[model samples]
Structure formats: C-alpha cells, structure tokens
Target: MFSLYALAQQAPSIDLIISNCKVINMADGSITQGQSVAIKNGKIIDVHSDKYIKNKYQAAQYIQAEGRYVMPGLWDMHMHFGGGDSTLHENKNFLALYLAHGVTSIRDMAADISKSVVKWRDEINNDQLTGPRIFTSGPKLEGYKPIWKGVLQVGTPEEVESALDSLQKLNVDFVKITENTLKPDIYLYALKAVKARGLRSSAHIPSSLTLNEVIDAGLNSVEHLGYAYNAGIPKAATASKASQFNAEYAKQQYRYMANHHVFITPTLLGSYIISHLDEDSHTNDAYLKYIGRGIKNTYSWRVDRAKNISAEASKQRHENYDNVSKILPLLQSEGVKIMAGTDAGYLNSFVYPGIGIHQELALMVKAGLSPLQALQASVVNSPAFLGLTEYGSVAKDKRADLILLDQNPIENIEATQKIHSVIVKGVVFDRRQLDKFLKDVADQNVSGL
Candidate 1:
C-alpha cells in the first residue's frame, strides 16, 4: 500500500502552476482570490484553491503570484501589418512587442503583408514562432484600380466569388472588405457572399450605403466609430457638420446593430492620436526606441499631413473624436458589443504596437466605460467574436494565455500596464523575460535589423 507521502510524491505533474493569485473572471468581472492555476499542453488543466491545488498536483515550472491579479491575456482585435515588403522585417518585430505587453492574441485587419502574416499565424500556432495568436483576413478584397497596393481587386460578382475562394484556400480567419475603392454594390454583394459561406465579415461601410443596409446585408462588424457615426447623419452633410450627434437616428442604428449581433471595433486610439497630433507630435516618445527605422519612417506622412492642417481643422478633428467617443456608452447600454483595438501598425502615426492596446483600454474608460467593461472588450468580447471558444478565461480547458498584473485591472484599467508576467501557451515569460523581449526589439531597431 502506498503511504500518503508516497501518493503526494506521485501526484500528476503539469507544465506550470500559478499560485496565490487573484483570478479575474472576465465573464462578469468577479475575482477569486487564493487560487492556483495548473496548465498542461497549453491548456489550463485545473484551477482551484491554492491549498487544494498544491496538494493535488506537481508542476514542472511554478510562479508564485504573491497575491497579484491574473487575467486572460489581452487581444488587440483590430491592428495591421502593412507598409509593403521593405517594412516586412520591421513588422515581424511587432510580434515580440505584443507578447511583451501581455497581448497574447491579435487580429490583423487586412494589410499588404498577408502572406507573411498567414505564415506567421500558422507557425505561432504550431510553436515554430514566438508571438501572439494571429487571426488575419489575409489580403482584403477591393475594386479594380483600388488605392491600396495589396488586394484582390474584384469588380464583378464572379470576381467576388473567386476572391472569397482564394481566401478560403489560404484558410484566413475572416473576411475584411473595405470601402476605399470598392463599389457600394459590390461591397453589399461581397458581404452577402461571405455570409452565405458562413464566414465572418468586417468592413468600412461605404458612404453610399446606410448602416441599416450594411447590417441587413450581413456585415458582422463596423471597423471604426466614424463609420457608424456617419450612418446616423445625412449623406449630404459636410465633414465640418459631421460632429452633430443625432440621438434618435443613432438610437435606431444601435438597436439595429445589437439585434443583428454585430460588433464594433472603435479603434479609438488611432483616431485620438491623429486628432491630438497638433498638440503632441510624439517625436520624443520613449516607445520609439523599440520601433524599427522603416516603421518609424512610415509615421512621417501622417505627421506631415497633420502639420499642414489649419488650426480650425485641428479643432474640428478633436471635436469629432470627442463627439463620436460619447456614443460608446450608449452602444453598451443598447446591448452592442465593443472590441478594443488599436489601429496600431505602419502608417498609423504614433500608435505603438503591444502597448497601444493598454492605451486603448484607458481611452475606453475615459469615454465612459467601467474598467471591467474595457477589460471585457479586449479579453472577452474579442475572442467571442472570433468564435475562439478556448480563450477569454482562466478556467479549466481554456488556453493558458494569461497575464499576472501587479494590481487589479478591474479596479483600474491602467493596471494592465503593470504586468508582472505573461504566459503564452503555457510558457511563462517572467518580468525579466518580458523586459528582454523589449530590449531585444530595441536593439534590433538600433541595429536596423
């Protein structure tokens, strides 16, 4: 007969254990203290009281949380990886930045670097690369002679079908259609086609299409707040008059969106940065050290464009951002889901990757969401929208993508920035390792690698 000590010594061994932590339940923002999480094979095998867990299992690696707060790793649902081949290496460097900032997953909303992005996505899943879980739309669909350099230009119904076929072949996470140069009719048709194929779709609604029309046509998400705001006003309204928030029309739009189960990725950080560029150029920003020369070079165009704007134009930009941001609370009240995303990548000016998602969360709180609501946008709503059932919680069977914070993010959204450690696929990255990720990227940037 095996003695008690012998049985304890033979307890099942797991990959890692995070003990004595407060686990934040993203489902409803509840906290369970004195908990221990056991992870094995990249999945949370069990979560129990620290005493119970310690007696029940042995782990190869252990993290003594020391009363820290633990939550699911964040997701940046709307970012990009573009700026052409020359910036590919610089863009690839963003992966480490995301992991360093406790972002374990990201959605690339279509960019010029689809091929590399797709390859990286698969490689990361297979443990061949180190980075956030990538969900990419691959190359987006556009019209003939589209302004974007990398796209599958389709003007006909048959072409749209073919474009979608290609996307399926690449096994993209979803379909992203933009309004830049795509015709309104084709855009509507593409949305319907994507829906018929049971593929999720997100888009920049065309000016010619009403918000109601796009929702009815099967657009799963509205990419930015400006698009939804524009839907509430008259098409004839000028840019200067776009700031007028129409309560009744917006209410109807919100209801329509909620009823259809559509999501909104406000990407507020990018707009906020651009709107306030006249005040802070971000040239002396400390985050610049981690960005490659090629990526930093891409920020010039947006900065120069903002510089030439008249004082009145700058004022209008600020007012527009403020007005549109106010609708976020209303959207939540009306039952619409918000996904926190920082349109952070090449050509978006100063919105830095990795850390940008934290800034986005703070902005969401400033725009009237509670800290929990903001947290849900990144960790909960984002994965649900992507149909990633295995993520978004620190529970049994959930993916072991988590972050240990120095403070409670539910109490203060900014607490996310105080990450003590990050775990991606059961591999723990302690403070030292996370800092090394940042330092390595910075060194690569300085060396022009």
Candidate 2:
C-alpha cells in the first residue's frame, strides 16, 4: 500500500476545478453551501464539500468562486434565426449575446434559415462554433402558400410523411407544426405520424381546435399561452368550439395535461410586449444596440400593425394579455410543467434574445410563480422537454453548463442578471470575458434599420 501523499499524487488529474461555492440544487430549490465542483473533459466529475475536494484532488486550472451561487445555465426555449443571407452574419452574432447572458442552450423554432441554422447547430455541438447548444425544429411543417417562409408545405398525409422523412434525414431534434393554413385533420395526422416515427412534436394550436382536442391528438407542447387562455373562457366550448376555461374545468384539463405529460411555453414576455406596444414604443431600449439592422427591420411589420390599432383594440389587447398571463399560475398550481420562453428573435418586436430569458423569468414570478419555480421553468423544465437527462442541474456527471451568480437568484429571480461567471462545456468565462462577449456583439453596430 502506498503512503497517503503518494496515493493523493497518483489521483487522475482533471481539467478544471471550482471551489468555495454555494450550489443551487435545482431539483428541490435547496442550497448546498461550501461546495466545490470538479470538471473533466466537459462534464462534471465530482461535486463535493469544498474541503474534501480541495484536499483530495488536483486540476489543470482552479477557480476561486468566493462563496458565489452556482446553478445550471439557463435555457431559452423559444427563439428564431431568420432574415435571409443579408442578416446571416448578424444573426450568427446572437450566439455571443446568449453566452454573455448565461443562456447555455436554446431551442430554435424553425424559421426561413433552416439549412444554415442546422449547420450552426452541428458546428456548435462539435465545438467548432461559439454559441449555445442549439436544438432546432428545422423548417416547420405548414400548408401550401403559408405566410412564413422556409417551411415544408404539406396539404395531405402523404406530403406530411414526406416532410417528416426529410426532417428525419436532417436528424432534427424535434418537429414543429404550425397553424398557418395547415388543414386541421391533416395537422392531427402529422402529429400522430411524428409520434409513430419516434419523434417529439410541438404545435401552434389553431383557433378552431380546443386545447383538449390537440392534447388528445399527441401534441407534446403548446408553443404559446394565447391558445390556452382562449380555452379557459366561459362558453369556450360552445362559442369557439373548444373546451371551457373556468377554474373547475381548467383543473380537469390541467390534470389531463399532467397525466399526458404535455408541456406549455407561456412565452408571457412576448405577449406582454404585444399587449403594451402602444403604451411602450421601445424606441430607446438599450438592448437594441445589439440587434442587427436586418432583424430590426423585421420588427416594423408587428410594430406598424400595433400602431394602426384603435384605442379600444389596444385596450382589448391589454385585457387579453392580462387574462392570458393569469393562466400561468393556474398551470403551475395544477402540476402542469411550464417552460419559460421569450418568443424572442426576428419579427417579435422588443423581445431581445439574450436578456429576454431573464425578462421571462421575472414575468413568471409576477404571474405568481416563486423564483424557484420560475427558474425551474427554464433550467429544469427545458431539459425534460427535450427528453434530455444529462443537463438542467448542477450535479456530478452532468454537463458543465452552469453559471455563477454574484447574488442568490432564489432570493430574487432578477439576481440571475448578476452573472459573475459562466461555464459552457467546461470552458470558464469570468466576468471580464463575459463583458468582452457582449462588447464584441455590440460592436457589430447592427442597429438603425
């Protein structure tokens, strides 16, 4: 048997070690103090008491966390990358914005730039690019002559199958079907077909169908909260030909959703922006400094439409937003898993990509979720949405996608904004480096469309 010193020296070396920290246990909203987390080859190898790690292990690099809070990096579940080639470089710059703000992963809903987005996703995964881990839906499935560009238009079951076949070839993480004139019956067919092919499916529920109707047809996640709000109104079943939205009925529907394991991305921040556009013009939003001219141009369509609405229409928009936003707490109370998404990206006015997720968390708390619950919506719920078991928490053997905050986020969700450091794939970026990422993006000067 070797001496203690010799045994300690024989231990295998790791790449990085972070000691003197408070690790947030996302699983139960608890905090483990005085901890040290170890990483090797881009995965967490050990997370133990600080003294234990400091005395027993060695690494190529060591970061003194200095009692800061560590938690899993955030996920932005809904965002788009589009605007054709003119904005390609500008759009690609959004990646740096995400990392600077502690967003380690994102779910890119399909846009016109499917092929390029796919390549970006691959490159990011292979460590060839600097960006969040991207899981894209490729080109969304829609009907012929759909308003949105870069979609697989399918009018029949055969067409739907062919589109899915193409998506399969692309090895897309999941499938996204929209309501842009896609026949309802065929939409249901596509959902079933996607399930049969062993794929997860999310959709923009059409007004003609009740929330319950779509859930029964194998829809895994609802993209936005507007449709669910519509389903909860009294006489919804009779007037809109969908289910009712009353509390008792809502309880039943939520129970059904929990049993079925369907997820919801309220994307309340986007709705808030839409409802209050008339009140807050966002002309001076400092975040605009980072948005490209081409992407800023995309905002005009929505803004112009919002500007043209009458006072009464604007009030109704506000009322609609209030009603929809209120449903967020109800979903949480009923055991329905919520994924925090910003609905951020091109064409969604004022919803910036990087910082939008923080806004989403704040809104969730305002809508009645605790800070822990709100954090869960992004860090915990998002991984489950993708059926990925390796991420969403700070634990041994987990991917080293995490953020170190100067303040405790559990005390206030806004503390997340005080990012002290970020670790993506075991690569550490301290405060100075994070600011450099932001500065690099702003230097693009992509504004002034």
Candidate 3:
C-alpha cells in the first residue's frame, strides 16, 4: 500500500475548487450530483466526487456550491455590435452586460466597428479587459450600395477575391456574406471561394437561389430561420401562403442539412419580440436602463417601421413566427444542429445582450425543445459548430467557463436566469459582483459616457 505522504505529494495544487455541485453533462443531458471541480490556469484539472476531490487536492480559493447546478457558461452564437461611431462606447458597455447574464462567449456577426471589435477580442483573450470571449467575422461582405452600412462591397469575382484577402488578413473567425445587394451568382461564387480557402462561411441565401444550391456550394451555416423556412417551400410557391408548411419538403431539407453538417441559428427570440411589440411596448422594462441612449435611439427605426404595419400585416407577422418556430423541433428531430442565438444587439429593438441567451433558451423550450436540448444549443452545439474543443462542458481538460445556478436548468429552462455565480476562464464572479456589473452599466448609460 502507498504511504499517505506519497499520496499527498501526488495531489496537485489548484487555483479554484467548486465543491458539492451537481454537474450538468451537456453532451448527454445527465446530471452528476455531489461533484467538485478543480480548476487551474483557466482549465479544469479534475472533476470527481466532492469527497474525493476535497481529500486529494488543495485549492487557493473555494466556493461551496451547496448542491447548486453547475454547467458550462452560455454562448450566444449570433449577436452584433454596431450603431455607427456615435454608439461605440454604448457597444463597449454591452460586454459587462453579457458577463452579468452568465454569457461567457459571443459571436459578433459583423458590424460597423470591426476594428474596435477585433481589439476587444484580443484584449479579452489576453485578460487585459473584462468581457465575454469574442469571435467576430470582422466586416461582412455585401454588394454595391448595400442597404446596411460598413460592409465590404464586392460586385465582381475580382472584388470577391479582394474581399476574402482582406478578411483573411484581418484573421476573422469566419466569413459572413449578406444578400441584400449581392448578386445571386456572386453569392454562390463567394461561398465557393471561402470553401476553397477552407474558411467557414455563413450567409443569407438569395431568393433567386435555392437552399440546396447554396449548401452544395459550401455554405456552412444559415443565419436565420426564414431562410430555412423558405427552403421547405417549392421555389415557385408563394412564401406568404399559409400552405408553406410542407412536412415532406421540410423533412427533406432538414435531412440534407444534417448530412452536410450545415448548422442553423434560429434566433427565434428577436422574431417573437418584434411580432408581439404591439401588445407589449417594453417601455418600462427594467433591462432598458442598462442600454445606452444612443443604442436605444437605434431601436426607433424598427419600432417606427412596425407602427406603420397594418393590422392584417401584424397578424401575419405573428402567424409567421408561430409557423417558423414549429420547425425548431423538427430540425432537432432530423439531427440538424440548431445553435441558440438571440440576434441581440444594436438596431435589433429590445433584444438585450447577455440575458438574451436565457430568453432564447426559454423560447426554444416554448417552441417544443426540452430544456436540456435548449441548453445544449447554447453550451454544446455552439462550441461544436465553432470547432472549439476547450469549451462546452463541466469536465476535466475543458475550459473552466461555467455558471452556478440555484436550481437545475434541465428542470426548467428559466432556471438559467437564476445565476448564483459566473466563472469565466476560472475567474468567478459571485451574484453580488454580477449585480454590480449591471449597476455599473446602468450608471454609465445614464451618464452617457
């Protein structure tokens, strides 16, 4: 038998230990109770029974989870940061808001402030700043006179080549292409080029081209559900018709997506909010206080446009949301990877950052997903889609980005919002500190700094 001195010498010293927690295994939705996690150098060094870990290892800091649920920190796969130069400071404040809401990572799907976003991403990675881990597409690719601002306009194949070169130089996480003003042919060409370079590409499918064509051309992901909905209908069929929900067509489309490994970020929460804006103006929402005036002003454009919509059109919007949301379950059933993204940020009225991921999970459950499945979308599927091997679970050898909740989220998705503490890169922020983060953002917003 080994001596106690030898065993003690073998035990590793760790930076932090979270004991007596129930670890939620995102991979299979199982819960391991009375577990302890040992973290060192921002990675989980060990995870085992609380008694075993407490007896073996020593930690510099300890958090008695007291039987709370511990799971991976949330990832918002599709969000933005842009309201032009005037709202740059406001956008910066969103970082704290994300941490306050237990979001450990975010994917910025292109915006006007590409340079600033890149700097912030680097700073956060280097631990020079406090914010969620950022993976930005830099500036998205568009066409001549695109509807949106701050895009790389590429009309010809040569211009597309130039755009890709620029994006590669900037070292963007992925390539984002929008179809607002881009020609259908160029869109396909850009997708092919991005594929040839071995870079993942996400985009809006042009109405002129079928989803199959885009996927076959090497499109990695579809940003919104509308495109997937459109794919389920015949090209000649009117998309506005209630008859658009063809089960056979949808099954075939979803099956193709699964086979090809094309991920989909439904972003259902934003659609739900906009669809029901007439019923709840959200003027008195407590979350609004944290949003800067400049960013809030950007909300008016969409709000004004919604006010002009006729009652019949408003009803149609509600119907459209319901119809599209129903397919979320179908997508999951068919083995399609559905990533949870809130589409939260500037220009998207009232879809607040940070807390938006929790709202998105709840909406996913409402749309027929199990709470565990919805949690997987944020913590599991997101990292898988991004090929991040270090994240997405509460286990040894994984990144120590986690959330401690008073209740199990698998029991009720809303429990995710009941965060007791957040740990990013092995750094813990208790409830009090998280609340302070929110308060500071609110104070900054009020001061317009």
Candidate 4:
C-alpha cells in the first residue's frame, strides 16, 4: 500500500536527510547499501532504509548522495596554528581554512595567540562562528632561555607548577611539551602535573627519555612517529656526536611502546613535505590562500632544509619512513591505537593546512597501512582518541560529519578525496560549493602575495 499519509507519519520533522548513499561502515570493513541518515536540530535522529525513512518521517530538506561513498569527517590531530598571531585577522582566517576542507576538529598543539585561540575555541563551541571545533594546548612548555616563541619556561619544579597553574587559568585543553625546550626532569614533571589535574598530555617525546619511560610516566600520546622511529633503534645515543649512530636502536625500541598501549601520531604529511621539498612541487594548492602571509613565507625554509641535507642525511631520512612501514602493521595487529595527524602548520615547513591531510593519508598507506586502515587512521581513530563520542563512525546517532566520495575508499584511499559532496552537521556542500570555497581561498592568497 503506497501510503503518502505514512510518509508524514513521523511527528517531528527531521532537519535534514541524506538518502541513497553507500555508507562506509567503519565498525566492520563492509559497505552498506540504500541507507539514509536523518537528522533533527544538530544531531542524527535515525539511520535506516530509504523506504522506511520515507514512511516514518518527513524531513525539512533531503540530500541525495547519488551513489557516493559516505564516511566521517577527518581530524588532523597535531596541526600547529601559532603563526596566525603576527597579523590581526590571521587566526580567524585559519579557522575558515579548516572548515572549508572538511576538517571538523583540530588539536592545536601549540599556538602563539594562546588567549585569542581559546576565545575562538569557546566561541566556536557556542556557534559564534563557522569554524572547526578546537582542542588547544596553548603555549608549549620550555625549560629556560627558550628559543621558540610563546613558551612557558620552567627551570625548577616550582616553575613547572607555576606554568601548569597559568595554563589552567588560560583554560588550556592539555599540555604540549618539547625536548630541547624543557629539562628532562621538568618535562616529566609537566606530564605528571597534567595527569594529576586529569588533563591529557601529548608531546614530541624527547631523546632524553626512553619510549618506555614516557609511557610509564603517563604520557597520553606521542606527537610524531619520530618517537617510534627512534624507539626502533638498538643503542640510542645520548650525546649529539653519537646521535647519528643510534637511529636503528630507536626503531628497535618501538615494540616496547606498542606492547604497553602507547598511541602515536605519525604526522607523515609533514614528513613527506619536508623530506621531498625539492622534488618538483605543486603551488596554489587550494589551501594556500587561507594561510597568512607570514606563515606562507615560512614554507620556503623547508626547501632550504631539503637542499642542505647531506646525501647521507637524505638516505637515512627515507630509511625512517621505511622503518615506519615495517612496524605499522605490527602496531595495528597488537591493538596499539594509531592516530593520524598532519602537524600541518608553519613549524612544519612545506605541509599546507587543508590539503596536507590527504597527503598524510597517502603517506600512511605508503607506510604499510591498508588503504582502509590508513583512512581509519585519519578519520575514525582520531575522533575516538579525542573522545568525541558521537563523531567518526557513519552510523545512527553520530554527527553528520561525513564526506561523499566518488569512489570506494576501501579499494583506493586516494579516492577518498574525489568528493561528490560533503555532509557536515547535516548541511550539504556539493562539489560546486567546495570548488568555490577553494577558489576564493586561492584568490585571496594570490592577491596578498
């Protein structure tokens, strides 16, 4: 019985419904057919067959995904956003860049506009602006006589306490610690302080501490795969002169962290850009415009590093990538959670903001992750790590943070970006909208240049 009345049977009209899309069920590697996702207000209301939804609820708006692959919006876990402080409107512009690229949440590892970024983070949560949701660590912690900008310098235990106190007052989400910037004791102390306060701690693991020590001390996450790369070695050198000899030992040490359930962000996009900065490149990458002039110029320094790296250094650099590939499957098999991060910001050199994430997915695939596994590293694993309960998976009750791909991502990960449309917060953005946004970003950057 064709009941038009049944179509309006549902009382509360859904705000949006995405129909006829192939849902990428991350829970298991299977694709589901003919499913529709319905949303009301800002939350997902239902997921079911198109016929069932049509018979049950009326939607204010309906988006036809037209045979596209639908999966969760991605998270770039370690993007630095500090360079925006040099200008008046750069931070605001940076937010726009992130949203335009389907990056729904970003972990600002450290940024200079500590208070300003916090203000924006709150504002975004309150829907004050159209920007990606933020989790920030405010200023990085340094030991003393710090070289980097916007650091909380600590010399003694008291200084560490003072820094943590200041960070809490500033409403920092977590703490990001650096090696050269912090003494080994103070570094470990900061990690403990953050843990004692019930906040998560993530950082660039120092060579001073064993990977085993950092995990034992309650570090929540490792910033980059360099930590894992170093862990794979057999004999880690403590001195600068011996530094060259111990990389293999570092790789050897990673199995220990994997055994202990330590999660790591490889941030391979940043590695790829810096590693091959001289390899003929792509400019006007659609994401470049949203970057402010100061940070945009910072990218040139990457080329210098690439050119200056001796042949010996370059060979070893590639070997690090190889080491990463060798251990990734093992890490995954052992249930060591791996999250994807781009480290996509000024300090990263060649990595661009929005565009770098796709590059990162590719590198993860290159480094021994199955295409589906690589995609999950970028999409599913990240939100889970951040504790976004209703995000990441393409299922009922999840936020409508999803990308519509032209091809099956499970078969070919690069197909993940072949966007047919984007459904975020239940708002539909078609290819046309995406193209326009990217063009606007590029034109703005070119004008500034």
Residue-level error in angstroms, candidate 1, position 66:
0.3
TM-score of each: 0.97, 0.96, 0.97, 0.90
Query: Per-residue lDDT tens digits of candidate 3, residues 95-200?
Result: 9999999999999999899989999999999999999999999999998998788899999999999999999988899999999999999999999999999899
Query: What Cα-based lDDT does every candidate model obtain?
Result: 0.92, 0.89, 0.92, 0.74
TM-score of 2: 0.96
Where model 1 places Cα greater than 4 Å from the true spot, the runs are: 234-244
For candidate 4, the TM-score is 0.90
Is 2 or 3 the stronger prediction by TM-score?
A: 3
Pairs clashing within candidate 3: none
Model 1: pairs clashing at backbone N, Cα or C within 3 Å = none
Candidate 2 lDDT over residue span 1-449, tens digit each: 46987978977799999999999989778999999999999999999998888777789999999999999999999999897888888789889999999999999998988888899999999999988999999999998899898899999999999999999999999999999889999988998999999899988988777778888888899899876676666542565322345777777777778788999998988889878988899999999888888889999988898888999989988877777788888888888899988988888898998999999999999988999999999999999999999998899889999999999999999999999999999999999998998787787674432
Against the hidden true structure, what lDDT does model 1 obtain?
Answer: 0.92
Task: Kindly list the per-residue Cα lDDT of model 1 for residues 330-442, writing each as its tens digit.
Answer: 88888899999999988889899999999999999999999999999999999989887998889999999999999988888899999999999999999999999999999
Query: Between 1 and 2, whose lDDT is larger?
Result: 1
Better of 1 and 2 by TM-score: 1
- Worst lDDT 10-window in candidate 1: 236-245
